[model samples]
Target: MLLKSITPRESEKIIKIDRFVFTTFANIEALEYELSLGIKKIEAINTNYYLKIGGNEERIAFEAKIYLEYLEHFSGLVEKIKAREPLSLSTLESTKIRKILIDSFSAKTKDWLLDSSRNATYYTKEFSIGGVVL
Candidate 1:
């Protein structure tokens, strides 16, 4: 007997994966404000990740850590730019910084998906169809 496999419907599957892109940008803005006020020591910045399936949501912790590291890297670049001249970045400079963050995060996420240990089970559950778990 050939058993058929069942997959989740489009509505049940993960509909959106949200990264803390804006949150990182906002934190960097706040950091710049503090620096302008002569604040040397700044608090750590954190990022978050979320997966949505219909009305359900799952918070991703491990991936958030990786994202936080990249956020810090971007923050360092901003600090360097600030140190050179306490002025806002030029249009070209802003574009380069945005590209760096986009490319770096894209590459990292691709690499992460390639790892065998990283599976959908992290945010999904096994479902049985006709007494068979697929």
Candidate 2:
């Protein structure tokens, strides 16, 4: 007779995303603003930038991309408001901005499970009566 040995195997998956490049001047400012919110700076800033938040590089890039897109989407409207010099928002424009704020809170990725692995387990129970196994 042979007894099988139980063993558990574990692994950690790390994904390293390629550094993101800022194309537009507004995107650079957006990046700076994002960094300021967290009081963070580029880890390696030479030809490109290396950014991470809570040790997640992908999240940093993902957020920057979203901010850039948001800025691009509303740039024209923003410029129009600014062009007035006084930069006053009409009731309609104010309502639109409020809607944007509401939408921003719901922004989330479809999948955030970046890493996973299969796991195994085993259990045993021992019985004894009057200092003798039964």
Candidate 3:
């Protein structure tokens, strides 16, 4: 141990601590920062990525992705969901509820895709009282 190089175990532990990093944005600048950071990591280490491609679809896809990741990373989540318990505080914290509640920063690429797509807008059950689309 001449220079005391970081062990794979230590590096992995550090990565595990940041296994799920999230950044919310009030504007495009904030989103850009996260994008840059995420891009940098791809070269430094092989990593799983969850880049929300657009603002409109952010809410639509956010919860499902986070939930899937949550289920994959922690078996306790699966057990809790199976047991039919009220979501735990920690689990609630882990969910992507902000996307459902907030208007996230719009990405140009996402905006373009949504604009070009025939059915771009999210369809929330909360949006309609009846069959009428809101």
Candidate 4:
């Protein structure tokens, strides 16, 4: 996926990937310079190292199964977002929507969002004026 093109503004950092929106107060020019290079796909592998002992095999297998399930769920979610599927806010509760918003961010951006001292704020009123309420 490519980073969506946006006009750089003072004191505002907005990055869009597919349907996800990431906002923060950081160096936008630096981010834009990084994106100007190119977008590269990075492959990640999850490995589990454990001793073949009593009960360990079962535990490792259970953990592996959970990890695979999570990967599958995340992959499907990404595909849906990339496809720009229609969102029905009326059918989804607030917590579920919040989870989707949080999951949309990249790991680093998500960390920033979760940081209590970051003082992040969502512009609900602005979004509402544009026809989106969340």
Candidate 5:
């Protein structure tokens, strides 16, 4: 997801968000925020985000579109949650849907990414889909 997820004030540089994958609606909101601020560009329908969480590749390749207007004001909305669904890293039997997003990384990797303000906010997920925190 590092490739798809981006920070809004990331170097004032424009990046393309070819595709985004969030199990929860919060992830969608977070992605919308970045795009609205021009932090990154969510690619069109023909193309999409490729996020292979572990061996979960099928669901990761799902298709979706990012509306033009939503990308225009993403910054304002990321702060205002749309969905709120609390979730777990794994489910009892639902493997088709994207599972809860638990940061799976070494302490060093997380520390390095968060210590720097340019990347600190990257680790902090926001919004939710009916309580499923993304």
Candidate 6:
């Protein structure tokens, strides 16, 4: 399945965990340097985890699914970088390099959009939750 079912509460927790993972990666100076090299592909690696986006929610087995995905993607990227592989856009961008770049940007963008839209300041006011009027 493309999306996993998660309660709103569980989804919130996953989001927090995702933020921490992103922070760790963003703190890497080499990552910034690599990003500047350019994106070879816009698509990203497929993730097993997903947050409920305004739809039917399901129970999550654990909160670590997202973490595991982050670890998998990060490990792959590190391996490619360590092997002296190119991590940038090029007419001849290798499959490995393209996969890494795509996964990195996809995760980053997903977290950004989730965090940006999760402002408590706006939610503090009267509004609906899970599409149901409060």
Best by lDDT: 5
Q: What digit string (tens of lDDT, one per residue) describes model 2 on residues 16-125?
A: 11111122311222211122223345555455454544531111111222232223332343233234332211121122211111111112223223334644322221
Error of 2 at 25 (Å): 21
Error of 4 at 23 (Å): 23
TM-scores for the candidates:
0.14, 0.15, 0.18, 0.19, 0.15, 0.18
Expressed as tens digits, the lDDT of each residue in 35-122 for candidate 5 is 1122334577798654433322111111122332233334433333222222232221233334332222111111125455565422
* Candidate 5's TM-score: 0.15
Residue 43, model 1, lDDT = 42
lDDT of 6: 0.25
Off by over 4 Å in 1: 1-69, 75-134
What is candidate 1's CA lDDT for residue 128? 12
lDDT-better candidate, 1 vs 4: 4
Q: 1-134 in candidate 1: lDDT tens per residue?
A: 31112222323212111111332212221111111222234345674444333432211111122232333323343343334322222121133211111111211322233247666322111111011000
Which candidate gets the maximum TM-score versus the true structure? 4
Output the lDDT of residue 16, model 4. 32
**Candidate 2 residue runs with Cα over 4 Å from true position:** 1-66, 85-134
Pick out the ten consecutive residues of candidate 2 with the lowest summed lDDT: 125-134
Local lDDT at 25 for model 4: 24
Question: What are the lDDT figures for the candidates, one per model?
Answer: 0.23, 0.22, 0.23, 0.26, 0.28, 0.25
lDDT of 6 at 87: 38
lDDT (10s digit) by residue, model 4, range 31-77:
21111223334455775444333221100000011111122222343
Q: C-alpha displacement of 83 in model 5, angstroms? A: 14
